[model samples]
Target: MKQIGNVYLIAAISIVGGGLFGFDISSMSAIISGDSYLCYFQQGPLNADGSCSGPHADVQGGITASMAGGSWLAALISGLLSDRFGRKKAIMIGSVIWVIGCIIVSASQDIAMLIVGRVINGFCVGICSAQVPVYISEIAPPTKRGRLVGAQQWAITWGILIMFYISYGCSYIKGPAAFRIPWALQMIPAILLFFGMMFLPESPRWLAAHDRWEECERVLILVHGKGDPDSPWVAREFREIKEWCEIERQAKAVTYLSLLSPKMINRTHIGLFTQIWSQLTGMNVMMYYITYVFTMAGLTGNTLLVSSSIQYVINVVMTVPALLYVDRIGRRPTLLVGAALMAIWLFANAGILATYGTNPGPGGVDGIPEASVSVTGAPSKAVIACSYLFVASYAPTWGPVSWIYPPELYPNHVRGKAVALATSGNWAFNFALGYFVPPAFVNIRWETYIIFGVFCVAMFFHVFFIFPETAGKPLEEVMEMFEDPNGIPYLGTPAWKTKNYYSATARMEHGEGLEKKMSMEASPERHEVVGAKEQV
Candidate 1:
């Protein structure tokens, strides 16, 4: 019980890295659409009384895309760095980077300075996003792995929720400080994450892979039980880990190139496409631009901020069910159901917008006509309802599942690299979406949700056809599922329906029943029993 308690504690702390990632996102999202932020960055003509106009669409897109571009570069390198220095150390480095970025952004005097600071923060977000899941998945027990790693997503949602409200509160302030205060507050979590990781145990699998067998044994004992180095659970787990490491040692040297080999290619594809599909779900469009979305839905001022806050509240609340039930009910069903529902809501939103959304005439700003009125009535309420529903569907499914699935696919030897590549893909796609969304809203108006709805439909099929069920299987056993020739066809099948299915931990108690039965038939005891019966 104590050992398990430690695992939860460590997970809770380490996942604050994820919280920082969420905080950066909400910090920017909450501020970018505000009038003060617009006035500060806006570069064109002033209003009749010489008041500043809001920023142009292109500028908003650039500011948002700049961070994603930095994340893209950092995510590509973070894997190699983590693989060399270790996951915990990489996370600490990322936290420090985040703090530095907060200071830079808070102190910025111009758009150039703000963009630079955001890019620096993006680098930190990329590192934490890639490493936190890998570290948590490495240490968590198989039965509890889903929720443990899923905790990262839980933290991210909490961060987003807290920052949205904080940004809302700050909106009441008089000047540029409104945004700066929220940006500065981000340092609190980053500082805590950096200091907190100092006392946590290193990933046992990573230790064993590096020939630190003694430390690995110690950690395994500490995490899996209390002071029992020779416990059956610990011994079996250690042996299997050592066996897998030896297999890698005897094979051709593991490298970034090795990820392309036939043995690993499928796993790599799964990781890469899962992230691609996740971004295609269009969750970030709502997250990063919720205020803008609400505005388009006919809300303004505090009404816009309050409506956006409700969207995030639903996001945080709905994600709880997934954290609790993903391990119990499994990954595939939650994702499939979520994807389907998301498609429904997005299309519904697009249809409502097409029917009821006003088309701006000439001299409109950011897709809204200068003469537009606040939308009231059933249609506007329906759009709000569908927007919340989209978030509710996503928070549990794609939001958390995308972060959890990739690390489970690869063996320890290449887990870091594989996850890194996948995370980079996520950021790369994120960059494109961030760059595309502001203009997409400006040019396409109500049809923007249609594009995402189509992507969601494609994602639903992609997951159903290609994604395997990894629930309840140990990391080692999950590797075998991919290695087995017969396993590929059955990848999508649930564990309960599959014949000869057993999790790695369960195998310890049950043994190899079929193999043991075959061995007993050839034994002398069986032959003598048959001879005695014939003589009698």
Candidate 2:
């Protein structure tokens, strides 16, 4: 089969796997606000007041969270599948599963059926979400790595925006069609990705690990060297990957537990924290429950939908700058700045809600209110702006960085498992938040923002203190930097003081090979041992 060699095309297509995630996020946001959807899920007659009677708060929260629960489990197991079957194949499998899930969801008749379908789709999200970045990171050159991997975030934003609008438009239709149409529409990207991945090359590093050296070299040549066999870039990268493969071949088997080894644990923490903190930033609340937030802010009907849709546009638009400049700006600064800005927005929004909002029932843990807090006038508008600004702050920073950073943290041997573990942490928190945030709105009201705001502040310090920069560094160099005994510091002259360590080490090893070759020239085994050592 003819393979796509352009990094951009591969990123664009493989990233379609994450599209369902975007769809699920904003689709539910858009669908749940519809009277038809509420009526359908309620499975009963409308209230005598002509209001749609939705499912109970707990049942609704479970329905909303079921997908994340499924995603968490799928992401946990995805690494083994990717390692055994290859990243591209793993993603292809995910695409097919997503299509099935979409079909089931579109036809769901009750809350249980809907939850089952969403959970199935969540499995697809988990598998694809874990591996797409792994695949892209392996194929992309170090300099372009950020842009390509960041494209995952950009694509997700696009999915969210497109699906949200589709659901918004479908909202006008009578009955369950309002929700079913959008669910059915989501299958397109998955089907495209299923067929699209057929034409995309598998990860070169994966090929190298399996000892398919020729295919690996060809991939490196085609993707990075512009088809030039003699290109210095390809020659250098191939050498590094080949060496890593050789090293890994002799290493012990890697498992999830292996990620906690002394050499790997710090990176595990970094990767895990990188993903965890992103969810803790409260971006998903704005995304998954935007309509709820807007509803509480006193906006209704088209005005609420329009207001919600604009944020999706902002999400898509804001991601572009990060997609272009993340490598240039470096990872550490983007994370720190993003966290700080998100903190400001969350804090400001929380304060505004606490001061301007009115609570009628003030529900407790056992007795949750139907509506937590309601605001009207300028304060509600200000609260809405804060939500938009929070998303704007997040889109360029944590949104892209979280997806890219974890895959960059480990060597090929453990990269799949480690990335999966990190992603599992992400989905775990995602599921927890998705499951609880709805009830939280009733129980605590404005305090939710306060928790996330503090998390943003804490994450800022964490990034500054412990998180090392990974942007533009070759995987081997990142590996060595973490393995260094003295350690890279955040406060005291940090993140690998030596530049070009990977290349320099490669040269030193090459020079040693030459000296050994010269010494072997006098030995009887010269013809056998040192004959083709320098060929690559």
Candidate 3:
């Protein structure tokens, strides 16, 4: 077999993990409203006589909530597990869980069984979500890192598109087949990931951390071939790892509470808030509850389905531009533009509904009056157009960039815990919006969009004030940026000048000295791993 560049090959493995994120998300969307899923334990559709017979509403809610809750819990656990066990192992274990979950889902006999299956799938998704980005971020070169790590978002969009088509096709079929077919189909990707991962290389950063320098070197040689394994270039890599490790070892003992200590606090804050802002930006509300959103907007029947699908299709289409421009144009500017526009669109939607969304004369009695259908002073077409525009702007910027930011922000040592904390926050907020959006729309109507608008406005300020430009930098350098959070405004300064900006005394006080220690321990090991490969 022909050998490929280590960088490209690693990227492919990262994409496999990303694909699992997509598959889980897509499969759930397809099954959420399906009868077989609702009926697996007697939660079927209402009988022809319109009797209250099948699954109780509470049971259905439990099934759906269990799946989502499982993911929420998994996101929290995955971080610590990935940190301790290594990213590749976490991913492989996640893939195994994914296969198991799919099997459970396919064979589920009752509502309780189906809910349990979904929880397992959620666990898998959470694990992959936490580790995949870390693996990609660690393995990718500084120059291509943004684009490579950003592939997770691209994979998600592709999954969303595929699921949309799957649902579109399934809708044409009858009975249990519609949902069951899509759920069964997900096993293919799960199996592929299982086998694909078996052949993939481990993250070099991970190897360096575990005192396996030689493995790190061989992997680097494969990834960065045509160079001396012991060259100066390689020396820089070892130095960085050594420095990081030394710092970790000397940081006066890192406990879970230490994540909030002065040295690490900013990073913890960044990770926490990024995830918070990502969820609060209302993206999940649009993805998970768009059908209900549209239905409340006076859309119904097939039009509702098609309109919702168009939103998903737009989400899928916009990811291409997001991947292309995120690294080029940078994270802050993209999010700022998107968030500002989203706020305006949300307000406009609310305004239109408040002014003209009234259903006069008992359900409005169909096309009784064109004037009644018209939103006060606003064209219905215009309102709908603006809503779509909001989606387009969000998809290309805030949507994918949100996922890209957290993995890039934290240092390698704390990345897993930081990512876990951040993503768990994300899913928790997602659960809130998922549970609330439907009720919000029903009870408050236009006011629901207003709340989202408010959050977008808040996000605009948060991104501008705190987020760093992570594009085109090595993970080590990215972590270094956090050493002086106050210096983010001077990112364009030369490296030496930036180093000079931090007082040597302050660096030591803030645990820079400790980072140096942890990073070095792996250097000898890295050399051994690389050198051994040469001898072989």
Tens digits of per-residue lDDT for model 1, 221-339? 88765466555556656777898899877777667788888777878988998888888999987888776677766676777778888887898898888888887677778778989
> lDDT of candidate 3 vs native?
0.66
> Per-residue lDDT for 278-311 in model 2, tens only?
9999898779888778877787789989999999
- lDDT by residue (171-227, candidate 3, tens digit) is 667666777677777777767776776676777788877778888877666665434
Q: How do all models score by TM-score?
A: 0.90, 0.90, 0.81
Please rank every candidate by lDDT, starting with the best: 2, 1, 3
The candidates, ranked best first by TM-score, are: 2, 1, 3
What lDDT does model 1 reach?
0.79
Global lDDT of each candidate: 0.79, 0.84, 0.66
**How much is the lDDT of residue 266 in candidate 3?**
72
Model 2 spans > 4 angstroms off: 43-48, 362-370, 486-536
Measure candidate 2: CA RMSD.
5.8
Over all chains combined, what TM-score does candidate 3 have?
0.81
RMSD of each: 6.5, 5.8, 7.3
Instruction: Give residue 453's error in model 2 in angstroms.
Output: 0.6
Model 2's lDDT to the true fold? 0.84
